[model samples]
Target: MSETILLVGHGSRAANGNREIEQFVQSWRERQPAWRIEVCFIEFAEPLLDAGLTRAAQDARRVIVVPLILNAAGHAKMEIPAHIAAARLRHPATEFVYARHLGAVEPVLHILERTLRRAMLALDAPDPKTTGVILLGRGSSDRVANGEVAKMARWLHEETSHELVDIAFTGITHPRLETVVQRHSRIGMTQVVVLPYYLFTGTLIERIQRQIAHLRQQYPLLRFGLGGHFGFEEEIFGLLDERVRAARADGTARAEHMMECDGCKYRGLAEPHESHHHDHAHTHAREVPA
Candidate 1:
């Protein structure tokens, strides 16, 4: 039976950011040539998610929509599924399954480590003991999503001996990227590593560069290193492949590596108004289904 893998990304207004997603998709096509692959966006870009789903349904018997999202906020939890649910009605004969977001995978913890390590290495291998860490996430109005980033920062702190690890948001929530990066720089730490907990780069990353630029001027002596986003990594592909297999086997929107609901403070914690947060595009991958 013909099958297609529809990779969905949050669309971006930035041309370069959108291009990177295409490049990412290209890599998948190069790696696996047997399966049909398609790319789509949720907003602000061409070939929106619905279009991709419709196109995939036309030629493939089985269609799997994999969201390249880094966090499980409204987009992942509510929007994407809503889109899939609607698409299912139009393509009732097509077998459709949705896979988990990237952050759900535990191995991504290592991706975070690796991202920070690169920044550390670039800064002359600063002693982890003396280095302060700031992990930036594309923040959400949903406190639950924001909390996941905090959890990641905590995990990073445990994995390494970094005495200070803080989480900051690029858009919403408390302690913006600038506030955390600047505060950490002024502290006693010899170095500060600003790492992004993102699937790929986008407008927000450019915004981060502005923050890094300003920090560089204020504290020239402090080793301020910025790390790249997780892009085209082998582990990423492996995890996505695993999700595809799991979803295909079960023929359901398999929420693999889903966050545990118990012990989740954000589930019941009071949060600010949801209107405070904004959204942006992120994601990548290319391939033909195997």
Candidate 2:
């Protein structure tokens, strides 16, 4: 039986952003040339998810749709599966597998913590332990997804020596960066570190930088620093490869740990929805080297 890998990215309007994902997939192909690999986007880029699935089913018996997202947000839960269900209709003979979203897993946590320590060292901060850290994410309307970020904050606090770790969003959620900055400053945290929990640069990161800049200007007494983003580095490929392997074993993209629901948020149900849009509105605000 022939095997195939479908790298589904959250398509961005910016060609560069789309290109970044393509390059990432290209690297994967280089490492493992045996499997037939295909890349597609959910929106804002050519070779959309439906098209990718159609193409993958042409020759392979098992097609693994690895969603290139950070959290178990709307896209992962709703949109990706909806597309898969549609593809199954077109090619009922083909088998489609879904995998889990790339959250703050153990490997990522290690990278994130290392990045924070580097940022603080670059700033020549007096006490890295006392500095407050903020894990900033593309805030989701789904409470479950938002809760994931909050949970990551607690994990980071335990994994690192930061005095206080917090969660903030770029949009569509409470406790935005500004609100947190004020609360932390008033509470007498001399230094604050904001880590952008993202794989690629987008408008949300730009918005975060601007918000942090303004906060720095407002509170000159306190130090504000931004950490490096989680780009399409070597570790990203490792994580996706692991997911693809798991999908191959389970015969589906839906992972065991992910919440189970169909025709819910990703497909836009009236009630009990689990996803929100913004996958395609990825404007270039930050750039990570390929």
Candidate 3:
């Protein structure tokens, strides 16, 4: 049976950001020539989910849509599933499977650790005791997603020698990049590094640079270093391959791999304090450590 793997990205306004997804898809194709792979965006970029699905359904018996998302936010929990449902009606002959998003898994966490270590190395091997690391996420109203980033930060802190590892969002939720940086400055951290938890470069990355510039001016005495996003590492391919294999084996996302939606606001399980947060435009850095 012919099978096609459809990789879905969040889609960025920046051309290069979109290109990164396409380039990554190309590399995946090179690595796994036997499997048919297709790339698309959930929004903002060309060949959106619908179109990508249509194309994939054209010549495949099974179509597995794998979200290249780091965390299970609204998009992963709701939006992508809606798209998949719509596609199922349109292409009944082809079996459609929804795979899990790549959360803060071990491989990606290792990547972050390597990136932080490189930044420290670049800054003349600053003493980990006085150095602070700030991890930046895309930020979502979904506390679960934000919490995952925080968890990842904690895991990273455990993996590295950095004395302090703080979590911040680029946009929504509390403690944005600026807030975290300012707090770090006030606390008199000798050296700080900003590591973006992103897959590619986008408008948000540019905004982060601007914020970093302003923070530098505000705290001229502090040594600040910026780290890169999680780019096309070999482990990334391994992760994708794992997702594909799992989808093929089960014809759907594994229950264990799926996001824990017990407390999802969309499911009406929101806490009493849960309220909708304002939405913002979406937005990625350094030669990632190999």
Best by TM-score: 3
TM accuracy, model 1: 0.85
Q: Which portions of model 3 show Cα errors greater than 4 Å? A: 253-257, 268-290
Give the distance in Å from residue 18's predicted Cα in candidate 2 to where it truly belongs: 1.8
> Relative to the unseen true structure, what is the C-alpha lDDT of residue 242 in candidate 3, on a scale of 0 to 100?
91
List where candidate 2 sits over 4 angstroms from the true fold.
253-257, 260-290
Q: Model 1: residues >4 Å from true position, as ranges?
A: 253-290
- Candidate 1 structure quality by residue, lDDT tens digits, 84-194: 767879988988777766664578888888888888889889799889999888877666667788888999999998999999877756788778767776778888899
Q: Top model by lDDT, which number?
A: 3
Candidate 2, residues 152-180, lDDT tens digits: the string is 88888988777789998877677888888
**What lDDT tens digits, residue by residue, belong to model 3 across residues 63-160?**
98898988778777766776777888999899888877787789988889888988998999989878989998888877778788888899998887
Error of 2 at 241 (Å): 1.3
